[model samples]
Target: MSAVFEAMIRFGLRLAGSQFPVFIFPLLVFIVFRWRAMFSSVRENPAARLLLSYLLVVFVLRFVLYMSGYPYQGRYFHPITILTVFPIAGGLLLIGRYIEKFKRGNLLAWLVLAVVAASAGKVLNPPDPKKWLKDIPDAIRANAPADGRRTELISVVEDRRLPFYAKSGYHLLMPIFGDMFRDAEIFLADGASETGKKLKGKGASPLDLEGRKGGIKLIVRFDEPTKLRAIAFLWSLTPDKMKADVSFQTVEGGDFLKAELVSSNQEGVVFRQELTAKNIIIAIDVKSNSLWHLSTVRGHGFDSYQVFTQGYYNGMMKWLPEEDFKFGLQSVTQAADEWGGDNVFILFDATIPEVEKALEERRLRGKIMPVGEFTTHKGKPLSLYRGIAPDRRD
Candidate 1:
C-alpha cells in the first residue's frame, strides 16, 4: 500500500515537473511556517475557507481517483493549479518578507529584476526542441487547405501530436501502427490466421485447441531449419484444468527435449532454448478432466512482429491509446481497401515497397504529391504524401 501511494506521488510529481515550473522550496517553506496562520485566516474569512476546502477536496479527490486505478495525465492537474493561485501569491509574499528581513533594503527589488531577466532568457535564447515531429503539424496546416471538405486521414507516424496540433475540420484515423507494421521474413502460423478474425486459428492450425479435453499436440514447421531462441504460447484453461504438462520435441515422433521454462501462468507458457530445427512438436497433457484452449503461438527466431502480434492477442496494449480504436486491426492493404475518401493523408514513413504497392493498387499513387519530407530521429526519411482519389475516366 505504501509503495503504491509512493509510486502515485512520484508519477504525479514527475508529470507536474514536465508540464510546469516547480517552486518546491518556496511552497515547502510556506507550509512549514504559515500553515497554522493559513487555517486561522480561513476560519476568519468564509470565502477563503470555502475556497481552501474546495481546493483540498478536489485535489485530494483527483489523487484518490488516480490511486483507485484511473489513468491520469499532467493536464488533469490544471484545475488544482488554478485553485492554488491565491496560495501561490501568499507564498511569494512570504518569501518577499523573508528577503526584506534578511537584507533590509534593495534585496526584493534586485530579486524581482533577476526574475524578470531570467524570464526574458526564454525569448532571447530559446532551447532547441528534442522532438523530430514538432514541426509536422505546422507543415501539415501550411500545405493541407482547410476548405471545409470532410477529410479523412490515416496516420502511421505513431505520434498523436499531429492530430492535436493540426487545424480542425479533418478527421484523423490512426490504425494499429507500431512494431506490427515492420516486415518480417517469417511469421509463424500466418496460414492459420483467419481472415478478418482476431486470435482465431482455423483448419489444421496449431493455435486452435478450442473445446479440447485431455492432451493436445501441436506441430510448428518453419520454411527451413532456423536457429531458435524462444517459443511462447497463449492459452486459457478451465479452472479445473489449471495445470498442463508441456514439452517440446524437435524430431518427428521422437523424445521430448527438456527446455528451460521462461514463463508459465493462466495466460500462457513460454520456453527458451537454443536449437536449429525445421519443425517443433508441442505436447500438452492436462492434469484434470476439463477443456483447454490455445489462442496464439510465437517463436523468436522469426519476425518479432509475430511475437508482438501474439502479445497483442494476449491483451497487450500494442494498439495506441491502450483502449479500443473503434476500428478493426488492419494492414496497409486492408486500410486502403476500406478507405472511401477523395483525398488521403499518409503521415508516416510510407516509402517502403509494400506500402507503395498498396497505394499503387488503389490508384492512389498515380496522383500522389509530397506534402512534407523530414528526417526521423533515426536518420531515416519520414515522408508525408497526399493521394488524390482515382478518377473514373482512366
Candidate 2:
C-alpha cells in the first residue's frame, strides 16, 4: 500500500511536470469542487470516456504491480505518460469552456499557450550534460602519449563512461579495486566448482549462493608470492548472518597463517595492509536461509599498476586485473586530496573551475601540464592533463 502510494505520487509529479504543466493542480482542485459538472462533461463525450478508461486501467495495473513489490522507475512511467495525454487535453478543454463562461476565455487560452511554449523549449534545448563529462573520453584519447608506451590513467572526474574507453594501450585503474585478484585462481574445497571457475579470469561473473547452507572453503592461489596493498570481497546481494575466516600463506608450501580480518559485514569484507602471500584462504559459513550473491574478489599489489579514481560506478564488473604496466602510487591520498601522477594522464570536466583549482593546490608532488582540450556535445569544455612527477619536473 505504501509502495503504491509512492508510485502514484511519483507518477503524479512526472505527469504534472510534463503533460499538465502550469494548470494541473488548479484544474484538479476545480474538478474536486465541481466534480458533477466535470463528470457530466466527460460522460457526454464518448472519446473522453474511452481515453479516461484507458488511463485508469493503466494506473490500476501499475498500482497492482507496485503493491506486489515490483520496481517502479523512469521506464515504467513512460507508458503512463502516453496514456495521460488524451485525458489532459480533455481536462484543458473543459477548463477552457468554464473560463469562457466567466468571460476570461482569452486569458485561459493564453495560459495554455504559455505552458505549451515552455514545454517546447524544454524539448528543443534539453538540459546540458553534467559539467561536459561526455567529452572526457575523447579528451583522454587525444592527449595520450604518441610513442606507444603503456599509459596508466586514473580519472577522478565523476564519469562512469570513462572506464569503457580504456582500450588498446590505455589502462584504467580504480584504487578501490585492487589489481592482483585477476591473476589469482579460485578453488572450492572439494575441487573447482562450476560456479568457482566462472570467477577465475577477466570479466568474472558473480557467484549465486542463494539457498545453500553450511561451511564453504575457497582458496585463492597466485603463481607466486604477491604483495598485497588491498583486498576486497564485493557482494551484489549480501547474505544474512555471515562470517568469513581469512588466512594467508606467505611462502610456497608454507603453513597458512591467520590474517586479521579488517572489516566484515553483509555487504562484504575488506583487508587493507602490506603483506606478501601466495595463497589466500577464505572460509565462510552462512547461517541465514536467504538469497545473496558474491560478486568478485579484488586486490592491488606491487605487481599491478597503481592509480586511484574517485569516479567508478558501483555496479561495474571489477574482475579485470590491471595489465602489467608501469605506474606507482607515491602516497595514500584522500578523495579530496589533489591528484598527482608521473607521466600519468588525468581527464576531468573543465567546466567546473573548482576542479582545476583543487587539482593544482593539493596535488601530491606534481604539476599539471595541459595535454588536450575538447568541447562537449553541448559545448561545455573538457580538459586532459599530465602530471609531471618530481623528478620529471625541472
Candidate 3:
C-alpha cells in the first residue's frame, strides 16, 4: 500500500518482462495441483496465503486506479513483485518438483536461461543520481539547523527514497508529481490540452477558446480572496515589442475589472497592481504578432507557502511556478528557523533560470549560487541554487 513498496515492485517487473512471469504463475499453479504433494499445504499455510493476498490487493487497487483514468504510469506494476515474492518462491519450488518428476532433459534449464536473458533485455533503466541532488540532503543536514525537527525537505526529483531515507533527519515532502490533475485546469490559457483539438489548421493564433475572443486568456480563481504579495513570471517574447493587459473578475460579475498593463523592459519584468483578488483573469491582447513562453509564477501566502506549476508544455520544454526563488532563499536565511523551516529545493540538469532576477524582483536582495556540484554516471553535471542572505523582503 505504501508508495515505496509499490515503486520497488514496478522496478522488479520492469527488470523482467511480464510475459514469462505472467505465464509462469498460472503454469506453476497448474503444475502444483497435478503434483499435490509439491507444497500442497501452501494454500493453507498462513505465510503463503498472506503474501498471495497482498499480491491480489495491490493488483485490484492498481486496476481500479488506472480504470478511473489516472495517468497510466508503469510504476504501479512494482508492488506486485514484492507481494508475490513468497508465493512465487514456493510455487517455483513446487514447479521444480514437477519438472524433476515429468521431464528428464535440459528443457527446464534452457527455459530459465531464456527468461533471465529476456529480463535483462527488457528491463527499464532508472537514471543515476546526480551529484548535487544526492549530496544536498546530507550537506544541508551537515549544516543542519540546531533543532532540525520540523523542517520539511522539498525536492523536484521524483526519486522514491525521499521521506524513507529522510526518516532519521529532515521530513521530506513528496515531489511535484507530473501527471497530478486539477479540476480547474480545464481553463488554463494556451495549454496544449485545451487547444490541441481546436488548433486543426495552420494559422490558429487568432482562434477563440472557451469564451475568450482572440489571443490567450489566462485565468486563475481562488475560492476565497487572497493577497498575492508577489508574482514572478518566467516568460519570453518572440517580437521586439510586446504588451499585455491584465484584468480581473469578481464573484459578482458585471464588468471585467482592469488590473495592470505590463510590458517587458530593461528593469526586468514589471507590473504595478495589487494582485489580491478572489479571481484574477489575464485576457491578453498581444500586439506585434508575438509568441510568448510562460515559464513560472510564484504566489506567496501563509497556507499556500509554495506553489510551483509547469504552466504549459508545448511538446518540448516545461515551465515553472515562481515559488522556489523565495523558498530557496529561505533555505539559507531561515536555515535555523525554529518551527516549520521554510526552504524549497528543486532539481535541474543545466541550472535554475532567473534565480537572481527573481530575488531582485521580489526585492529580496541576494545572490543565487550553486551549493553542490557533481556529475552523474552518464557524465551529466547538476547543482542546486538558492538565494543566499543579505536577502530580506522589501
Residue pairs in collision within model 2: 178-299, 178-300, 179-299
| Candidate 1 lDDT trough over 10 residues, lowest sum | 285-294
Instruction: Give me the candidate number with maximum TM-score.
Output: 1
Q: Write the per-residue lDDT of candidate 2 for residues 1-394, one digit (tens) a residue.
A: 4434654685567545654355555456556666786588678988758767877887787655543323346566567777655445666776677778878537667758976897788779966565444455555566555655444455433345664564412333333223333344444331245224423321121122211123333444554444343223322111213334333322234532211221222232221111101111121101110001111122232122244322333455332322333343332222112333443565544533544455455553334566666666766565566666545554
Model 3, CA-based lDDT: 0.37
Error of 2 at 356 (Å): 13
C-alpha TM-score for every candidate = 0.46, 0.43, 0.36
Residue pairs of candidate 3 with colliding backbone atoms: 9-78, 10-78, 295-320, 296-320, 297-322, 298-322
What are the C-alpha RMSDs, in order, of all predicted structures?
Answer: 14.6, 12.5, 15.0
- Tell me the spans in candidate 1 whose CA falls farther than 4 Å from its real position: 2-4, 15-22, 42-48, 68-71, 116-152, 157-342, 349-372, 375-381, 386-394
Ranking by TM-score: 1, 2, 3
Candidate 2: lDDT over CA atoms? Answer: 0.42
Q: Which residue runs of candidate 3 sit more than 4 Å off their true CA positions?
A: 1-64, 71-105, 113-133, 142-369, 374-382, 385-394
User: In lDDT terms, how accurate is model 1?
Assistant: 0.42
lDDT of 3 by residue, 1-394 (tens): 5434554465445435543454467355755564464345557678755665676788777755533323356656668655545445556555666687887776556656665676676565544545544466565455333555432443334343543344322222121211121111213344344323322112222222222323333333323222131111211111223244433332322332111223223321222111211012121211111111011122221112222433454453333333343344343334323223223333333333443454466554433345555455566544444322233322
| lDDT by candidate, in order shown | 0.42, 0.42, 0.37
